[model samples]
Target chain A: MSATSPSRSEQVPLAESAPREARESAAPAWRRSPPRWHGVAEALIKTTALVAIVAIVLIFVFIAAETLPLFTSHEVRAEVTPSTMAWKQTWGEAAARWSWQPASEIPKYSIAPLIIGSLKITVVAVLVGAPLGILAAIFTSQVAPRWLREILKPTIELLAGIPSVVIGVFALLVMATWTHRLFGLEHRLNAVVAGCALSLTIIPLVFTLAEDALSSVPKSFADASLALGASKMHTVLHVMVPAALPGIAAGVVLGFGRALGETMIVVMASGNAALVSWSLGVSTRTITATIAQEMAEVVHGSPHYVVLFALGAVLLLFAFATNVLAMRIVESFRRKRGGS
Target chain B: MATIEPSQRSPGGEPRAAVLTAAPSPKLEVRGLDVFYRGEKGGETHALQDVTVDVFPREVLALIGPSGCGKSTFLRVLNRMNDTIPGARVAGKVLLEGEDILAKDYDVVTLRRRVGMVFQRPQPFPKSIFDNVAYGLRAHGLADKREITRRVEQALGRAALWDEVKDRLDAAALGLSGGQAQRLCIARALAVEPEVLLLDEPTSAPDPIATAKLEELIAELKADLTIVIVTHSMQQAARVSQRTAFFYMGRLIEVGATKQMFTRPRETRTEDYITGRFG
Candidate 1:
C-alpha cells in the first residue's frame, strides 16, 4: 500500500504537466466532441416513434369510419332494424334462430352466439392460466434457489416466443384428437380445445409480468417479516403477494385481452360453428374468427361487410377498455403503496 | 425464568478474576464465534474471527467499532440472522438461556421469538399501525382477536407511542413520521415479548431529539429486557450502555465498564480509537 501510493501521487503531476492538445486527443471518445451524426440519429428515432403513434390513430379512425356505415346503411335497416335485430337474435322464431349464416336465402346475423363464444373461451383461458402463472411466479421469486430461479425464469419466457400458428397446429392435430378420445365428445374440434390452447399462449405473458412484480417487492420487507418470526410461506402469502396484487391483476387482464382477440388458435381448434351453447364439448365461433373467416368472401359496401368492420370496432373498444382498467388498478395500487 | 450465572472466565477464554468485582447473570453467551462469507468464485472473506461476548441480563452492552469492523455482524449472530444469507457460514456456539441456538436441529423460529432485532432503517409494513404490531402475534397464532387487540395496545403503550397513535390505530403505518415509524417498529418487536432485544444503530436515521427519546426508551426498557446495541457514536456508547465492547479489524480489543473504557482503556488501540487518533 505504501509503495503504490507514492507512485500514484508521482503520476498525477506528470499527467497534469503534459500538453493540453495531447491530453485532449488522448481522451476517450465520449469525452471528446460528439460526432455530427448523433443529433441526426436522435431526431430519426424520435420521428419514427411519432410516426408509429400516428399510424395507430389513423388505423382506429379508418375502422371507425368503415363501421359507421353499418348503423346507416338502408339495406341493413330494410333487412332488420338494430333493436329488432337484437330482439330476433335473443328471442325469435325457430326457423329465424340464433345463427351466423350470412349468405343464406335470408341472411341471419345474430351476434349473441359470437359474443358468448368469445366470453366462454376467454373465461376458460383466464381461469386456468392465471392461477398457474401466479403460482409459478411465486415459486420462482420466493421459494426457488438462485440457480434454479436463473434456469426457470428464462425457460418460461421462452414459451412466449413460440409462434401462435405452431400452437394452433399442435392443438388442431394432437390435442383435438386426444381430448375427443378422452372425453368421448360429439365434436372433434371444440371450445375446450381452443380455450386450452389459448391458455398456453396466455401463460407466458402472465408469468413474466407477475414474476417482475413479485421480484420488485423490496427485500427489506421480507427481512423484516422473517426477523419477526414469520415463516417463509407466511411472509410470501400475506405480505409479498398482497403488495404485488395490482401487478398480478394487470397481467391477468392483459391475458384476458389477448385471449379475446386471439385468431389463429381459436379459428383452427374451435370448429367454426356459430352456435349459442354453453357445453364445452360443442363447437363455437368467436367474433375475431367470424371476421377472419367471412371478411374475404363478402362484397364491398354490403351489410355483411359493414358488420364485420363493426366487429373489428368492438374488438378495438374491448382491448382499449381492458387496458384502461388495468392501468387504473396499477395506478391505485401505486398510490396506496405510496401511503398518500 | 432463571438467568445463567455469569462465569469468572471472560468470553475470550481468559481469566478476569483480578480486575472484575461482581459478575451478573449472562442472558446470552457467545463463544469463539467465527464468520466467513464464501464467494461463488471459491474465495472466502473472514468477517468475524474469535468474537466472544457475554450479555448480562437487564444491562445495555454497547458495541463500538469503525465501519466494516464486524459490529453489525456480531449483533446479527445473537439472533441467528446470518443464516438467511446464502453463503454465510458461522462456526461457534451461541447459547440463549443455556441452549445452543446454532445447533442444526434447533428451531430458529422459536429462537427468533425469544430474541428480537431492530434494523438500522425503520421498516414498517405497508398496513395499518394496529396490523403492524399485531403481525407477529397473528403469525405465531398465539392469541385470538380480542387478545391481539389487547397486546397491540400494551405494546404501543410500552413503546411510548400510544398517546400519539391511539385514535389512529387504523391509519397506514407508512404515513407515520420517521421517528414514529421507528417507534412503531419497536412496538412491533415488543409485541412478541422477546427476552432479548438486539438494536443495530437504532438512532442512525432519526433526528437528535428522536435519538434522545429512543435513548431514554432504551434506558426504561433495560429494567425488563437485556439489550445488545451496536452503535458508531462514542458518546452514545458512553451514555446508554453499562458496559462497552471495542472491536477493530474483526477482533475484540477491550471489554470493560463504559466509564473505564472511555477514560483509561487498557489497550493502546482502544485508547486511540476512543480518543479519535484514528479509526
Candidate 2:
C-alpha cells in the first residue's frame, strides 16, 4: 500500500504542476484583448465593403429617380400615346411600320423593332456561345493536361480583359468582311456580326463559371465512378455534366444578360437600322444601341429623352431579372444537393 | 522462437479449416511489390516496400497497421486504383490467378471490374438506391432493364439491405443512414459480381453497431468472394480474418494465421506490437 501510495502521490503533483506551469507561462505573454490597430483595420475593411455596396445601391436609386418621370408625367404619356397611335398617319400605310425614327417630321418611336432586334442578337449569341463555352470548360477541367490547361485557360480568360470597344472595332472591320464574304450576305454589318462579336465576350464569362462549377465536384465522386469501371469520357458526360447542370445554366443566364446589356459591340456592328425583321443577315438596333446612339443628341426632358430613359429602365429590369433567375437556379441546385 | 515458414499450398489444397475444405487457390498474389511517389520538390517517398502476400479464395485476409503503413496503397495496387495518382510508380509483380495484372497493356477497366473496392467513407452516388446499385451494370452494359432490376435486387439482398430499403428503392441514396449507406455501397459493388472485394477501413466512419453489422456482412461475403480488408482495429482483424498481415513503416512485418499471430508471434516487433509495447 505504501509503494502504490508513493507512486500515486508523485503522479498527482506532476499532473497538477504541469498545468500550473503552463498557466504561469501563458499568463504574462497573453494580452487581455486584441491590439488597437487590429480593431481599426477590421473596421476599415468593413466600412470599405459597406461603402461599395451603398455606392451601388445609390447609383441604382439615382437611375430609378431619373426614369420615374416617364411614369408620373402626362407629357411623356401624351407624346408616347400619339406617336404609337399615329404610326400609319405619320409614315403612310406602307412605310409607316414599326420603326425607330425619332428625328423625323413626326418622331415615330415604336419599341417593338428594338426589342425584337435585341432578342435576335441575344438568341444568336446564346445559341453559338453557350455550347462553345460549356464544352471549353469541360475540356479544360476534365480533359486537358495540366500544362495545356494552364496555358489555354489563362489565354481564353484574357479575352475577357480586352475592352468591349476593341472587340467592337475588330468585329466591325475584320469579322464583318470575312463573314460577308463567307456567307455572301447583303449587309456586311448586321445582327449576325454583332451577335457573333458579343458571343466572344460571353464565352469567357460562361467558361470561367462553368469551369469553377465542374472542378468543384468532389474528386471522390469521380473515383467512385471510375472504380465502377466507367470510362473517363462516360464519367465526364454523365456524372460531372449532370452534377454541374445548374451552374452551367447560371453561366448561360449571366451570359444572356451580358449580351442583352452590351452597348459598344452592337452600336459599332449592328448597323442601327431599327428594322423589324427576323433575319440574322438584316441590320438591327437593340435597346442598348438605341440609348448609346441617341441619348446624347436628344433634348433633355423631351419625349425621346423619356423614351430612352424608359428603355434604360427596361434594360435595367431585364438585367436584374436575369440575375435573380440565375441565383434562384443555383440556390435550387444547392437545395437539391443538400436534401438528397 | 521457431520461425514459421510461409505456406506453399497448391491451388487444390485447403487454405483455411474454418471455411470449406475444398481445393483452395490464391485468388490474388503480390510479390516483392514497391510503390514510390515522386514529390513536387524532386524527392521520392517510398510508400510501400518489398511487400509480398497472397489472398486465398473465399476467405478474409485483414491488413492491420498504423497510419501511413501502406495498407491502403497495397489494397489499391490489387485493383490498379493507384494508376489514377500522378507520379505514383509501381514495380514488381501483382498476379490475379497466375496472370500478371501489372503487365503493360492490361485492360484496367476489366481488372477493376474483377476486383471492386469499398472506400473508408460511404460514397453513394447522388441517385436512388436502385440506380446506385445498377450503376455498375449500366456502365458495363452488362444487362437489360429486366435483368438489371433483378440483379440490383439480388445484390441488395446479398448486402442484407433489401428489407429495410425495398420499400423505398427509388429514394435518394444520400438520405440513408451512415450504416445503410455503407451497405448500399456494398450492394453497389456486389452488383458487378466481382470475384474479389477490397475494403479499405470500411467501418472507420461507422458507429459501433454499424461496424458490427459490417463485420457480419464480411463474414457472410466470404462465402462468395475473396475479401481483403485493411483495418486499424486489432480486435476486428482477429474477429474477421482467417489470415492477418501486420505492416510497419512501408514494410510487411509479419503474416500468419490470425490466432497464431496474436497469441505467439515469432518476430519481437510483432510481439511487442500485439502486446501494446510499441507500434
Candidate 3:
C-alpha cells in the first residue's frame, strides 16, 4: 500500500494546481485586489475624526487673529490698550477705577466689572445647582428603587434638552415676579434670577455625570460597608460618596465651565446692566452677554470688536482648562486605585 | 504539624460520630431557610432550598461546594446582605442566640453589628488604611477619637496587618497588594467586634502564599469569634475549618467534623463531590 500511494501525493498537487492557475489567471483584476470602498471608507473616517480638532483649531485661530489688532493697531490701541482694559482711569470729573463704558466721548474700557459679574453669577448658579444635582444623584443611585430610577434618570436627563431660551423666558416671565415679591428686590430680573435660571442647565449635566460616577462604584464596596454594620445612610455618605468624589468634582468643574460661557439665559434674564456690585439682587452683565449684545452693533474691526474676541479667547482657554482639570482628576484617581 | 494543632483543638478534633453532637447552645441556628431571587423577566430562581444548620460559638464552620451551589448565598444570609439585592426574598427563622433575626420588626442595624461579613474579593474602601478600619466603629457612633484609633489598631493587629501598615496608615487602602487588601477588609469587619464573622471564599483571589497566610489567620481568629467560611477548595476547608458542610444543588448534603467528613463522607453525593467525581 505504501509503495502504491507514494506517487499518489505527487499527482494531487498537479491536478489541483492546473485548475487553480487557470482560475487565478481567469479571475478579474478587481477580484485580486481589495474592495474599492475600503480605502475610501477608512479615509473618510479618518477625516471625520480630524473634523473636531480642525474646527477647534480654526476657531482658536480666528479668535486670536481678531484679538491681535487690539495689541498691534495704533488706532485700536489708542481707543483701548491692555492697560486701559485692566486698570482704572480717571475720566474728567469722576475718578472711576473699573468702569466698562465703551460709548462715552472718552471711553472707559475697564473689564473688572465684567469679570466680577461673571464670577458672581457663575458662583450663584453652581451653589444652587451642584448640591441639588449631587443630592439627586445620591438618591437615584443609592436610595431609589429600580423602577423609580429607570423613570427618574431619563426625566432628569430630559431637563438638559430644554432650550436655554425657554428657561430664560421662564425666568423673565414667571420667576422674576416671584423673586421680586419674595425678596423685595429693586430689580425683578437680576443676577440671582439669571443664576437660578442657569442652574436648570447645570442640574442635568451634573446629575448625569455624578450619577454615572456614583453608580460605577463597585457593588462590592456597598456590600462591604453594609456588612460592616454601617447604616444605609452611613454606607451611602461615608463609603459610596467618598469613593465617587473625584468624579463628582469633575462633574462640578464641567458644570462650572458650562455656567461660565452660557449667554442666552444670562442675557435675557440678567437685565444687561454693567454695574459691579456685591448684592445678588442687582442687575448684572456677564462677559458672554456683553459679546452677544455688542458684537452686532460695534463697528467691525474696531477696538470694541477686538476686545470681544479677546473675551472669546479667554472663555475658550477657560473651558479647555476645566476639561483638562476634570480629566486629570479622573485619571489620577484611576492611577491611585490601579492596584485593585 | 505545629500550626495544624490549633485547628484540632476545636470540637471537630473529637471522635463524636454523630453529626450534631450535644453541644452548647448554638450561636446562630438557621431553620427552614429558603431564598428566592426574582429575575428581570419575572422568573424566579431558587437559590437556596429548605436548608438548616447551626454555627456553634467560636467554631470555624467551613461551607464547601461547587460553583453556584448556594454556599456564598448562605454566607450572605448570616448578616442579611441579601437585603441589598433588588428582588431578593428570604423565608424562615435565623436565630442569633435565641432571638430571631429574620423577624419583621428586627433591627437590621443591630443584627448586622452582631454579625459582620467579608466578601470573596477584598473590598477595602477607597480611603486611607486607618480610615478603612475606623469606618465601622464610627458608624456605630463611637465619637471619641482615641477609642476609634485604639479599636482600629487592635482590629488590624488581629488581622496580622498592623505592623506592615502602621507607618503609612495614611496610604490609600486600594494601593495595597491583593493579600494585604484582603486582610484590611477583614480588619474592617473585625473593628465592630461582631459575634459572628462570615467569610465568602476569602482566599479564592490570592496566590498560594497569601492563601496560606489567610488560612493561618483564620485558625488564629477562631479562638475569639464564631466564623462561617464558604470555600470551593476541599483542601482549604480541610486545612482551616473545624467542621465542614458540603452543599449540592442548593441543599446541605452533609455537615460533620472536618476530619470525619473528608475521610468518611456518609452520603453518596458528598463522597462524589469530595473525591472529585463530578461537581
Interface RMSD of each: 1.4, 1.6, 1.8
Question: Which ten contiguous residues of candidate 2 chain A have the minimum total lDDT?
Answer: A81-90
Instruction: Give the clashing residue pairs of candidate 2, or none.
Output: none
Q: Please, what are the lDDT tens digits per residue for candidate 2 over residues A131-245?
A: 9999999999999988999998998899899999999999999999999999988688998999999999999999998999899888878888888777788878867887887
What Cα-based lDDT does every candidate model obtain?
0.85, 0.85, 0.87
Model 2 interface DockQ: 0.51
Q: Scoring each candidate complex against the real one, what DockQ results?
A: 0.51, 0.51, 0.51
> Per-residue lDDT of A1-340 in model 1, one digit per residue for the tens?
9977876676576569878876665554676577889999999999999999999999999998987766787876665445543544432446556766778877777777888899888888889888989999999999999999999999998988989999999999999999988997879988889998999999999999999999998887887888888888989998899888888999999999999999999999999888889988889899999999898899998888877887788788889998998899888876665563
Model 3, range A28-119, lDDT digits (tens) per residue? 46755778899999999999989989998898888999999988999999888888888887778876668888877887788878888888
Alpha-carbon error at B62 in model 3, in Å?
1.1
Per residue, candidate 3 scores C-alpha lDDT tens digits across B121-221 of 89888888999999999999999999999999999999999989999998888889889999999999899999999998888884998898899999999
Give the per-residue lDDT of model 1 (tens digit) for B222-276: 9999999999899999999988999898887888779889988889999999999
Residue A249, model 2: lDDT of 91
Q: Which 10 consecutive positions of candidate 2 chain B have the poorest summed lDDT?
A: B1-10
Q: Which candidate leads in lDDT?
A: 3
RMSD of each: 6.1, 5.9, 7.5
Residue ranges of candidate 3 with Cα displaced over 4 Å: A1-42, A324-340, B1-20
